[model samples]
Target chain A: MTREGINQLVEEHVPKLVETITTHIETLTAPQRLKEAMLYSINAGGKRIRPLLLIATAGSYGSVTNAAYKLGAAVEMVHTYSLIHDDLPSMDDDDIRRGKLTNHKVYGEAMAILAGDALLTESFSLITDISEQDLAPRDALFLSSRLSEASGALGMVGGQVDDLAAENCSLTLDELESIHRRKTGALLAFAVEAGGLVGTSPKEDLTHLRKFAEEIGVAFQIKDDILDVEGDESAIGKPIGSDVDNKKSTYPSLLSITEAKRKLRNHIEAAENALKSLSVPAPALFSVLSYIELRDR
Target chain B: MTREGINQLVEEHVPKLVETITTHIETLTAPQRLKEAMLYSINAGGKRIRPLLLIATAGSYGSVTNAAYKLGAAVEMVHTYSLIHDDLPSMDDDDIRRGKLTNHKVYGEAMAILAGDALLTESFSLITDISEQDLAPRDALFLSSRLSEASGALGMVGGQVDDLAAENCSLTLDELESIHRRKTGALLAFAVEAGGLVGTSPKEDLTHLRKFAEEIGVAFQIKDDILDVEGDESAIGKPIGSDVDNKKSTYPSLLSITEAKRKLRNHIEAAENALKSLSVPAPALFSVLSYIELRDR
Candidate 1:
């Protein structure tokens, strides 16, 4: 896939992803403050990367138009729910997210929290609904388990727990990697692997797809840490120096920029390596994976 | 089934529910605080009505043990999660639950919120695990759908939204009924219905069991309201009039005690009617439904 092809995929799917999510959010019980809060954080977009990954990965092998769209939408719902809960007054307590007042800040804390809970449950419901189509039952179940495992305690929540515990304390690189692996990496892996899990992708191809996603996942987090230190607030849409302020350990904090860049290179290679054995022509997925490691924002 | 039978059923399942929840809680990632808050709320002794409903309903028609236990434990997790979130600083802002400090009060607002999110996700994960079991794929899918619908916006969350919106206002009896139906009725209905969904119960049996649960669910809420005004706090674990202090609407608030009692009787009768035509003996379920309508604490 050419650079233009990747851009086109993003442009097309980003809008559709937003539309799907918007419709799903509308289906939720309304006039409640928390539901609104959840929508606020979600609609206040951040590139819709996870959904894009699902679509892009699926597109690499087949016409993932149907499964990709729903899976993409489902992942964003989960992501948005996590952010709302994480930003609650009792959690990370962020007053602003994406250049605006956080969900709890605007909608009040209770709704923000419940909105998160509702979104999480809605994710499973949405995925299961996809199976109502021609997709096989095993595909739906596999996809559901992959997403759940990635988002549940063994993955993202596990990472969040570690992240919280490690606050104000120094950590070895391995500890930080372990946290990032579960927190940031697991979902990305799911985003790609889920595409394979749902699609008719062969076992070998699916294995490679997972490897590609795993490497890029780590590199993406490293880039995020780097961007936080130097990126513009207007461009990033969040206050700079939050990691520093929180005394949180991060890639940039633990490694020199040169070393971080080297590590990013290694992960990018690992990501690209997963594509080596693929039977499907996946220029778009390849471009996205490469950009994930090197992109500035 | 007699009084001894109900007690025996509770004894058989409650210990297992407690053990399963505790074991899962112990496996939580770093930040012991979050896990502690979750465990505190989950293990706090209630009558274990929801799980018992699942088990008893499953057992009524045929033998139920393995899958029944899983569904029973899963519903309690969902119920526990709701309680944790309901007590958050932004929600009810309660300081106590089940005669102990609420999740938020013990672990701070943020951890309590995450704990709830975790439990909700875990519930779905628990259901999904059934896909690997002996049940047919479609049956597993049906079980997942039932669980989500009962707890999602159209059900438990919907009721919660109404409850939040009705605060500080004088709600009509009908309006209050709508709130309780979703907030309280949906899960209770699902609790019994999911048992049938996961078990060998036939379609007609499932329908009758759900009808029975729906009536008892509303009656359960009415009894709760009455107990709040008149029952012993020592047994109830919270102070009498907490509802009044919160300015919450209830059956007794909208109707005189005599009228409320009459409505409770009507619901209990409806519940019995739903079960009277069942092919299988469900004496324990009947007794429990009767107790729900009459219990003071």
Candidate 2:
């Protein structure tokens, strides 16, 4: 498929994915304030790259099913919750995200915390809901298990802890990569593997998909670092140089911007090579890889 | 079973439950500080009431399986996570919990929040681990779904939002009950219902168990209110009259202490009556009810 074809596919499916997520949050019987806070973050104009990637990969295997949408929304919810908490006063202390006021800036800190907590809790509930329908119980179980592993202590949260600890201190490239692998890469990799699971791809194929995701995951972060140094602040939707202001290590800080860009390109190539091992053509997946490589935000 | 027998049962099982929970936390490959913060709260003395209730109820139906212990630990983790977040400076800002420094006090606010997040995320992973063993995947899914409902926006977090909003305001008895039912009662109810699920109890029995749990859950909160009004700070493991200090509504604030105690007894009786509808006698469950009524802390 051409880039326009993939763009059209994303355009068609992204709205549906948003609807799925909004409907889930809208139908919640939670308190109005809590629900509003949750919806605010959910509708905060994210790129929806994670969920769309999951759906695109799943479509490569078979027809996109409700389970794909549900799981996609679930992963997005986790991503959004992490963003919410990451922006908290105690964490990143960011005032803006996705070009809007952060959750705590609108909702009080307590409500924002609860909103993040509720989103995280409800993401699993959303996954389990899939088991009642198109997905098998074991598959749902597998998804939830892997998701928790990817997002939990040994994964995203653990990486955040290390990142915080490493602030104002130099980190070896190996240490930085270790942090990013768990911090950001795990969830992205899970999205790819989830699509593979939905596709009932062979174990060998799942391994390759994981490798593909890991490379892009690192590339995604490298691009962010590069953007932090030189990309347009308005385009990125947050202030540039915040990483340097915070005195944190980044790809461009550890290596020059040129080297970082080169590293990013290498990762993209590695990801493409991993896709070559797949049993079937993955044009949609390839397009997603390009989108990740090119996205300004 | 006699009271001694019940005490012995709790004695035998509480240590095992603690071990189960600690083992899960210890096994994490997370960063050291994150794991330390998590283990600090997990090691802090808790009554193990929720998990014990789950185990005892499961025992009443049949031999408690590994699934029971796993689910019990999972619920405890959720309960512990809530406590960790609740004590945050952005939330209740309490410096002490369970006779020790609150997690944030020891680990800093960011680490505390991450610890809570890790625990909550790991709880579902722990549940999924059960699916690999003695519990059916469908059953594991059911427990996880119910757990999220009990703890998420519509339940614990929602109730917490209301509870925070209601602070310094006079709440009607009905409003107080509504808040406590979701805040404290929902998870307690889930513990009992989880027991039934683990026992593979019939649907009717599950309903009865839920009713029983709901009643006692309210009673548990009432006891907490009463204790807040007129209990030992050391025994309760926190400052006394904190609800009054915070101007928060409580059973004793809404009604006289005499009346609140009377209400507590009524709920306990209702809980006992619900248990009577079970197909088999639940001596262990009955003992738990008695423990709830008589406990000083």
Candidate 3:
């Protein structure tokens, strides 16, 4: 599949996933105002990169089951919750996100906090919904457990802690890499592994999936850093150099853009090799890898 | 078991549950600052009312097991996370809890938010740890699902939203009741039901437990309302007139203190009747109900 093909696939899956997310979230008896706050953020456009990654891998296993949408929604909720919390005045203090007012700016900090929390709690319930012919309750439990691990202190939260601690401080390249791997890489790993877990991928195939996830995860982070340095702010829906405002270290800061791009290419190549090692033909996964490499924003 | 016996039970279990929570949270690679923030809140004493309810229910059924501590800890984590978030400036805006500086006040807002997230996420993982015992992974999933339900927008968050929305606005008694039922009652219900769930209590006993939880939950809220109006500020670890400062409606505010006491007694009687119906003798649960009625803070 071509890179454009993957982009198209992502476009298709994103709306579907959003629809599912909206529907599931609406089922909760939250107050009208809180629901409105949550929906405002949920409708805000993200590339749905995490869900897209899960779907691509699931498709490769011929396992595009309904449960995948539920899982996809769960991951998306987790991602959305992090974004909401990160945008708080006490965190990034960003007033705008996704080309619009940030959650805290529009909803107020208290509501924004609650909205983020709602999304996180809702994510767990959504994962438990992954029960049917294709998935058992135990399978749902495993998925939920893995999601928890990825998002918790050992994964995304831990990484964020490290990232915050590194602010305005010079960090060794290895430390920077460790932070990226934990903060962003953990979720990416979960996204890739989720597909296989739901599809019941063989152990070997799961290993390949993990390899693919690790390489692309680092590449994705590097690209994000590169974009922060040079991408169009409007297209990115955030300021290009807000990383500078945070005084946080980034890939481009640690290594020149040229050097970061070189490292990015290295990880992309590793991803390609991992994709090739998959027992099943995974053109969709390959397309996703290419998209990560070539995406400008 | 008498009231003293129940007190002994709480004393014995609270530390063990806190120990379990500490051990599991330590396993996360979260930054030291974030971990400190979380531990600070988790260590704050809130009477550990929720976990005690669960242990009491389990004990009465002769169903006490190693897994009870894990479940108790998970409930405690959930309770702690809510307390942390609720105390945030955006939420209840309390600066102190348990007569100590609140999490955000001490750790700053970002760390407090992340700490809450970590505690909540780690909770699901702790439940999954129940897998190696007599319980199945499915049971863990069920417990997690229920906890999410209790804590999510539909439960605690939803109630909070309503509570916040009601602030500085006139509220009917029914509206006030709904808010309490969702905010505090949902978690209390979850705690009571959890004991029966992990112990696999008989269906009739589970029904009775739900009934008991419902009555006592309302009674607990009423008691809290009474304390808010009349509680010793230092003993309560918060300002006595906070609800008044927020211009919020309360049971004592709507019903006179005497009327509120009447309502409280009605619920306590209902809880006693429910406990009487249970297949197992639940002296500890009865003691808890009585304590709720008699306590000043």
Q: Which predicted model would earn the best DockQ?
A: 2
My TM-score estimates for the predictions, one after another, are 0.95, 0.98, 0.98
Steric clashes per prediction? 4, 0, 0
Model 2 misplaced stretches (Cα beyond 4 Å):
A1-6, A131-133, B1-6, B131-133
**Candidate 2 chain A: worst 10 consecutive residues by lDDT?**
A1-10
The lDDT values for all models are: 0.77, 0.89, 0.86
- Candidate 2 residue A292 C-alpha distance from true site, Å: 1.3
DockQ of candidate 2 (2 decimals): 0.93
The per-residue C-alpha lDDT of model 3 at residue B29 equals: 65
Candidate with the larger lDDT of 2 and 3: 2
* Standalone chain B TM-score for every prediction: 0.94, 0.97, 0.96
Ranking by lDDT: 2, 3, 1
DockQ per model, Cα: 0.60, 0.93, 0.83
Worst 10 residues of 1 chain A by lDDT: A29-38
Residue A63 lDDT in model 3?
Answer: 52
Global Cα lDDT for candidate 1: 0.77
lDDT of 2 by residue, B126-211 (tens): 89988456888888888899999999998999999999999899999889989988999999999998888888787778878988
lDDT of 3 by residue, A1-297 (tens): 677887778776877788899998777777988888888898888778899899888888775888888898999899999999988988878888879999988889999999999999999998877665768877788788899999999899998888877889989889998998888999989999898887777888877888899998899999999988999998888888988777878888888889999999999999999988888888888888888888877
CAPRI level of candidate 1: medium
For model 1 the TM-score comes to 0.95
In model 1, what are the clashing residue pairs, if there are any?
A1-A283, A34-A111, A90-B110, A91-B110
